[model samples]
Target: MGIFEFVANNIYYTVPIPVYVAVLVVLLCQVFRRIFISRRPSIMESTPLAHKTSDLSHYILKSDSCPALQVTPDTTYSWRDKPQEVPREIKPGKYFLTMNIRKLDPNDYIIFDERFLSEYRERQAIIENVGPGKIFVADPSDGGALDLCEETLVVTVDFLVTRYPSMFRKTERGVFCIDAGEEYDLVTRPWSRHPLEITCLLSGEDHILIRCCDDGTLRVAAVGLVYSLNIDWRSFIGKELGSIHKDAHVPFYESALQKSVDRYFQKLPPDKLISRANWLTQVGPELRNDNFPDKYLELVSTLPGNTITPETIVNDLYIRVERQAMRKLPSTNGVVFKFRVYATNIWDLEQEEGIPRRFADHIRGLPEPILRQKHCLECADCILKAMDFMAEQQEKEKFMNSYD
Candidate 1:
């Protein structure tokens, strides 16, 4: 008999009616169960900053290595414990134009130090001297920028007050800063100022760069650069990420680094926060530097290779480091970029363990192009020689102390 005829005969003669009915009932029950589950609330989708957030694709889809990334809430920062002293993260490796990023806990997002009061005053004075338009600014036309800034400001206030209750408190009169002696009635007071400016006054960090994604492009929507850090942030507002880097004259960004950064921004999830540090050698004053690159080049050119010595290295040259963090905003689907700038003596940098050799190596590793931009070409030899002198002095002291 043919295959079709044999199967037809088996369906009628071999199979029982109860067996067909049971199979049909089982299939119908599975369909109804799935429909009920689809209507139910999911624990994973409930919270943005949950231990784990998953979509239906997580169950239905499978990747080659399905490793799950998780972030644990830090209890120490939440409880407002004093943070320990951290050594300068400045090192030899990852000094080049690269995104050296790592996980950042939400609790320890904003940093406060002994210099908070001074920094706050300095920034406010800057605002007074120069208008808020030149410092803390937002794009007037971009509605998304305002919403993103306001939402971020709200988050910042709650985060700071919760993390450091002793410093930031909520009294009968709205939020208060103990050190600054400032109070704001968030409810009744007319908010004449921009949301980013308000955020600048409340936090120890003066520089806040906000980039919001619009139509697949991430652009600088608002900037709270209260302190003068060379380039004016007002001009930076509304420029896309690519233009910002190009305007800042970040070396190799357009050529080698833009695509990588774009990919990183694309993959950044709302629940994750990442931090990185970048360093540059600066000559003269660390603050109020307008057209820093041209000025840096001019200053370096005047001091020829012959004039640099160990005595004047720290006095003339400074190692300026910036610790930056990129945080994903769940509410607005935006990214808030924050950076804290610190200038340390090059002498102090060499004093750190293994830094002398590592620092020397780092300078030599860079190509001729960046070396010229960073002014490493002008000072690298002198800096290395001075580091050697420091190293020799340390060895001599150690040998002398052996008798003791």
Candidate 2:
């Protein structure tokens, strides 16, 4: 009563006491509701960063659980009706396209989605950038890449003919018909055209064939690597698994993960299929090396130093995710691996509650060997900055929530 009397007497000499008391009551209710009744922002809400934020959020926010490998009965990929444009790096005048693929926690072994249009568009762009010569490098003497190329073509044609005969028919010229104007000679083709057909049909997906050597080691035989990140296809074509993953501490005999990987390959039956995902971040969309068709060595020669700034790392960075699928070819007894690459901005990470903190924690906790293998030393400062910024934001949110 004293408080009310004081307010009524002192608020204003001209104002009515009842009107002032009513306004005071309304103001108090609003403050009380704001502090005690409202809910905080939901962690699962869609972020402004990417259209598929909700889908990607499930993977980013948690350590993926290793699920049982399932067989994908056929190769009829669900195609997106429309293809969306992804960002590419901008060089002063020249344009360079890049796809980011990073190491990921153990997740589901394989994924088959309707990505026909998306894959076709990216494949077209890759072809235009790299051309046929570099995109499909299969020398009969090199053996594996070309052999795998042929096998992949056969499988692709078989799938098309069997599953979607309306879209694929047999031509009188001994060619497989895609449409009235388009026909592919899967049988009589030169070694080169086999890879071409594989690329044409599996537009968005990149292929690499691995075969066991006489010495009981695995080697990368052939790769339809149109969207490679940093590494050249030629360099990896004939390399062993250990040599390929040397930087990541993957030892054939020593590391348990390495041993399990080998065991998985050895035991993977011809009809069984398995897949996994890997993720990484880069400063910009210009990830694929400029060595697509030609000038690989030239591009390597002029490559920039590994120096990067926190500002650039934070502002220019984006996430790169690769969905990898592996299965054994019943005929050749060789394993085919598909790397389907996708990119999303790191800002997507900000959308999930506790994600930024989790990312910061993971990066901070990385061991020296793993850190070096990730090539994260150069971007360490920027990455750390991002982590810290996320932490600060989280702290501010917590403080605000405390009142509620």
Candidate 3:
């Protein structure tokens, strides 16, 4: 019999309806599994989100095998507190203010660096709202007059004011809230209250302006950077500066800070010189304590150019210093510094087109360092040095193998 006819005849005689139904059910189950049970791609796999913020990808620290910033919430900033004063009332004029609130995850906020502000000058307020730190404001608006109002300001409150009083006391004369239909002539009452004004004006939109509460209130405003006064000062002093590790710690801290400063300068653009100057005053003390005044000042100086030589030196010094510090640490089991170093090196290598493919391949093939291993001070130093040496050797090999 022909194959089709024989099969048809056999099916007609032996095939059961229940058997075919069972087969159909199995196929349907598989289709359903494929539709519902498979894992979807993550945000990183998705199309790049708007690069409207600073490209922090470069700033991300990585190490051989560990994930990013896995430190527990306890070690980081707490976001559980609510603000005591919720800006219940804002009127025209200037004021000094602070909010009490939780520290948001890094992903939730945007960094408003000076370059970012210049790039999107039209949206400065918006950028400021998205940043992680405190901000300063000035108002050109004259009281509540609609035509007289200059700009609409909007500020988002995220943090809570823990120490400061929440209520506007009688002494707080410069601060007042205007009801929807209040009338005050700025020309007449400009000097009636403390000239230091805090204005909440409604032009087309609403904005809150906090003027300088006192003269020379140095507000260190920047995106990405948050003022962290709660750093483990004791741990740093003991481990990074104490007698047991003083020899290594002091030099390491100094070198690291210097490198960070150099890096800050190398990466900063010329137009941001003013902002850098402002930042230096605020962060300079911390940098000096950490032993990196040169790099810090260099960034503050605002020299022009995209040169990588200084940056390279900074990076080398940073690695050396970090390695030395790691050697003094109590333990490294969950430490992230090494992985950050490796990732940074990989990124730098990838940027150079002159690097040979074979050398790159060798680096790609090397096993990543295990981050979970409990890091003793010595172990941390060894791992960091090894990674740095490997990176350097890879670059050397790539250069040697490459054609001119």
Best by TM-score: 1
Worst 10 residues of 3 by lDDT: 320-329
Cα lDDT over the full model 1: 0.63
- In angstroms, how far off is 37's CA in candidate 3? 8.0
Higher-lDDT candidate among 2 and 3? 2
For candidate 2, write residues 87-178 as lDDT tens digits.
22112222122222233322223232455544555666766676756666553455344445555555554444444444454453334444
TM-score of each: 0.71, 0.58, 0.18
lDDT of each: 0.63, 0.53, 0.25
Report the error of model 3 at residue 66, Å.
Answer: 18
Cα TM-score of candidate 3: 0.18
Ranking by TM-score: 1, 2, 3
Task: Judging by lDDT against the true structure, name the best candidate.
Answer: 1
Per-residue CA lDDT of candidate 1, range 44-110, in tens?
1312133332331232123221122232323243212343233355455435656668888665577
Query: Model 2, poorest ten-residue lDDT window?
Result: 89-98
Whichever of 1 and 3 has more lDDT, that candidate is 1
Query: Runs in model 1 with CA error above 4 Å?
Result: 1-87, 91-97, 188-190, 212-214, 290-314, 395-404
